[model samples]
Structure formats: structure tokens, C-alpha cells
Target chain A: GAGVSQSPSNKVTEKGKDVELRCDPISGHTALYWYRQSLGQGLEFLIYFQGNSAPDKSGLPSDRFSAERTGGSVSTLTIQRTQQEDSAVYLCASSPTSGTEAFFGQGTRLTVV
Target chain B: AQRVTQPEKLLSVFKGAPVELKCNYSYSGSPELFWYVQYSRQRLQLLLRHISRESIKGFTADLNKGETSFHLKKPFAQEEDSAMYYCALGGGRGSRLTFGEGTQLTVNP
Candidate 1:
């Protein structure tokens, strides 16, 4: 893809239900990132991936929020047991390498009811 | 820990007015600072980086190590510049960015 792509531009789920958001990063990019954007909160770092391995997961809000990338390309963010506070835009970005400019996806708006 | 702070959540300015968006960060090592902007209904894009020292669309930001601030400034604001601006800090190689809360800039004609 010419840019980072996120699936299901919008997702609404009931409390306690699990949801999975997917991301397809730009081809050949070695670095991928996940962020959560809430109203007034800005972008919160969630995870960072380098070649399919996550070197940083400290930003994950809780254990229920987990993510993984495979083939050094597509990635998935799974939220177990959604909460109302979890409602936010989940953004995905990819860079040619670490510490470089990142290209972002349109973002998946997750609304937990 | 690395963190970025943007004090203003909203800013308004008349066209051709000077504008400044303040940003401050706390990082142990020399950090990479960047300004990202998002126009209405558009994706977030890079406006400039402190490392480049180049101006983009008339906007520039300088990283002040003594003050730990990277403030974005422009001599003349334009309507097209109205958007949400974010300040981000990176810990260097293999590190993720820490973003500020962002400021919504509105330029009234």
C-alpha cells in the first residue's frame, strides 16, 4: 500500500466483548507503531514493533490490550473486554526505520458501548 | 521517562497575525523533536523537525535544550494553517514517540 492502512475504519462493540483492529503498514518499512487518540488526550503510545518483534510494550494501558505484527508487515491490536473509556481512535503508523518520520493510517475509531 | 507537554489546548488568531505554539519535553538524553499537524478530515502529517532546522509552510520550531522546549512559530498566520498541532519527542534510535496533548489552532479570517 502507498500508505499505512487500518481495517474497519470504525468499530463499535459492547462492554466485555473483545475486538481486534488490524493495520497494514507501508511496504518495506521496518518500524511500526500503535497509538490511541482520545478526545483531548492527544496520541498515547501503545506499542512499537521492529521487524515483527515488539521492543516496547510499556505503553499498553493494560494486559487486556495486546498487539502483534507478523511477517514484518501487517499488525493486529486486540482489546479484551472493552470498556467505555476504551473508546478512542486507534492509529497505526509505519516508518522506514526507527527514529524516522512516520506515515499514519486513517485510523480505526473504536467505540465501546 | 520521556514526555511532551503542550500547554494550550486551543488558540485563535486573525489572519496575518503572528502565532506561537509552545511545547516542552523531558527526556534523559538528547531527544528528537517534531511537530505534526492535522487538517480537518486529513491525516496527521509532519510539519517540521528540530533536527532539520528548515521551515515548512512558514512555520518553524527550535529545540532549546536549556529550556527543554521546541516551540512552533510563524510570523504570519494563514487560514489554511488552522488545524490541530502536536508536539512529539523521540528517544532516538529504536524508540517510540511521546506526544503532547495537542493544540487546536483556529485562524479567523
Candidate 2:
């Protein structure tokens, strides 16, 4: 893809439901990242994937938040038993490699009612 | 841990006026700082990075390790500069970037 692509641009779910956000990174990109943006707030780091190495999960807020990347191209962010506080836009980004300027996705706005 | 801090949540400036958006960081090692922006109904985009040491859209940022700051400055503010700005830090062998709370800059005419 020419740019990072995220699925289901908007999502609304009941509290405690599980939601999955998907990201398709640019071709040949080696780094993928997921972030959360609350209402009128900054991007919150969630997880990072570089190649086949272990992912950096340091930023995941809780055990309910998890992510996985397959074949180093597509990634998914899963938030289980979502809470009201989880209502936010989930953004995904990809860089040609680590330490480079990243390109971002349109983001999936999740609304936990 | 590496973190980015943007002091102001809202900044208002007049057209052609000089403007500055403050940012600070905390890290154990050398920090790679970046400024990202978001226009209305647009996705977040990178503005500039400390390592590049380049200016974009008349905005420049100098990384000062002595004070742990990377402030974005512009000599003449434009109406199009009215947007949300975020300061971010990227380093420590991770692909992720840590971002600040963001500052909404409004360049008034």
C-alpha cells in the first residue's frame, strides 16, 4: 500500500465487548506501531513491531490490550472487555524502518457505550 | 522510560507574529524528538524531527540536551498553522513513538 491502512474507520460497541482494529502497513516497511488518541488528546503509544523480533509491548495500558503482527505486514490490535475509558481513536503507523519518520493511518474511532 | 511533554494545551497567535510551542523530554539516553501535527479532520502527520535538523513550513525546532527541550518555533505564523501540535520522542530500540498531550495552536488573522 502507498500508506498505512486501518479498517472499519469507526466502531461503536457496548461496554465489555471486544473490539479488533486492523492495520495494513506499507509494502516492505519493517516497523509498525499502534497508538490511541482520546478526545482532543495526544497519541498514546500502545505497541510496536519490528520484523520477526519480539514486539515492544511496554506501552500497552493493561492486560486487556494486546496486539499481533503476521508476516511483518499486517497487524491487529485487540482490546478485550473494553471499558468506557477505551472509547477513543486507534491509530496505526508504519515506517520503512525503525528510527525513521512514520506514516499514519486514518484511524478507527471506537466508541464504547 | 522516554517521555515527551508539551506545556501548553492551547496557544493563540496573530498572523505574521512569531510563535513558539514548548516541548520537553525525559530519557535515560540521547533522545530523538519529533513534532507532529494534525489539521482539521486529518490524520496525524510528522512535521519535523530533531535528528534531521531541518525546518518545515517555516517551523523549526532545536533539540537542547542541556535542558531536555525541543521547542517548535516559527518567525511568521500563518492561518494554516492553526492546528494541533504534538511533540514525540522515539528511541530506545523501539519502533514506537511516545507523544505529548499536544498544543492546539490558533493563528488568528
Candidate 3:
């Protein structure tokens, strides 16, 4: 892809339901990132991936939130037993390497009702 | 841990007016700072980075190590410059990027 791509531009799920968000980073990019954008909290870092391994997952809010990247390209973020507080826009970004400028996707707006 | 802070949530200015968006970060190690902007209905994109010292779209940012600040500035603001701006900090290799709360700038005509 020319830029980072995220699927299901918008999503609505009920409490206790599970939701999956996807991200397809630009070809040959080795670094990927995930973030959550909320009303006042701003962009909260959720995870970071280098190649197919995630070295930084400290930003994951809770045990319910998990993510994985495969083939050093596509990534998936899964939220189990979603809560209303989880309503926010999930953003994905990719960079050629660590410490470089990142390109972001349109983001996936996840609304948990 | 590295953290970025953007104090202003909203900023407004008239066209051709000078504008400055403040950004501060706290990190023990040398950090990489960047500014990202998102216009209405568009994806977030990198505006400039402190390391490059290059200006984009008339915007420039300087990294002050002593003050731990990387503020974005423009002499004359244009209406097209209206957007949400974010300050980000990177902790070098194998580090994750941390973003600030963001500042929403509105350059009115």
C-alpha cells in the first residue's frame, strides 16, 4: 500500500462483545505502532512492533487489549469484553525504521455501546 | 519513560498572524521530537522533525535541549493551516513514539 491502511473505518459493539481492528502498513516498513485517541486523553500509545515482534506493549490499557503483527506487515488488535470506556478511535502508523517519521492511517472509530 | 505535553487544547488566530504551538517533553535520554498535523477529514501526517531542521508549509520547530521543548512556529498563519497538531517524542532505537494531547489550531480568515 502507498500508506498505512486500517480496516472498518468505524465500528460499534455492545459491552461484553469482542472487536477486532486491522492495520496494513506500507510495504518494506519495519516499524508499526498503534494508538487510541479519545476525547481528552489524547493519543495513547498502545503498542509498537519491529518486524514481526512487539517489544513495547506497555501502553496496552488492560488485559482485555492485545495485538499482534505477522509477516512484518499486517497487524491485528483485539479487544475482549469491550467496555463503554473503550470507545475511541484506534490509529495505526508505520515508519521505515525506528525513530523515523511515521505515516498514519485514517483510523478505526470503535464505539462500544 | 518518555512523555510529550501540548499545553493548549485550542488556539485561534487571524490569517497572516504569527502562531506558535508549544510542545514539551520529559526524557532522560536524548530524544527525537516531531510535529504531526491532521487537517479536517485527513489522516495525521508528519509536519516536521527537530533533527531535520527543515520547515514545511511555512512551519518550523526547534528542539531546545535545556528546556526540553520542541515548539512549532510560523510567522504568518494561513487559513489552510488550521488543523490538529500533535507533538511526539521518540527514545531512539527500539523505542516507541509517545504523543501529546494535541492542539487544535484555527486560522480564521
Taking the tens digit of each residue's C-alpha lDDT, what string does model 2 give over A1-113? 67899998999999999999999999998999999989877778888888888998988999999999998899999999999999999999998877567889999999999
Candidate DockQ scores, in order: 0.64, 0.54, 0.69
Model 1 reaches what TM-score against the true structure?
A: 0.92
Q: lDDT tens digits, residues B2-103, model 2?
A: 777898999999999999999999887767788999999999899998888998999999999999999999999999999999988877455356788899
**Candidate 1 vs candidate 2, TM-score winner:** 1
The per-residue C-alpha lDDT of model 2 at residue A60 equals 99
lDDT of 1 by residue, A55-94 (tens): 5888899999999888888999999999999999999998
- lDDT of each model, Cα atoms only? 0.91, 0.90, 0.91
Clashing pairs in 2: none
Put down candidate 1 lDDT per residue, B39-98, tens digits, no spaces: 887878889998999999999999999999999999999999999999988887766767
Give the per-residue lDDT of model 3 (tens digit) for B1-109: 7888899999999999999999999999989999999888788999999889999999999999999999999999999999999999988877777889999999999
For model 2, the docking class works out as medium
For model 2 the local lDDT of residue A75 reads 96
What's the count of clashing pairs in each model shown? Answer: 0, 0, 0
Quote model 3's iRMS: 1.4
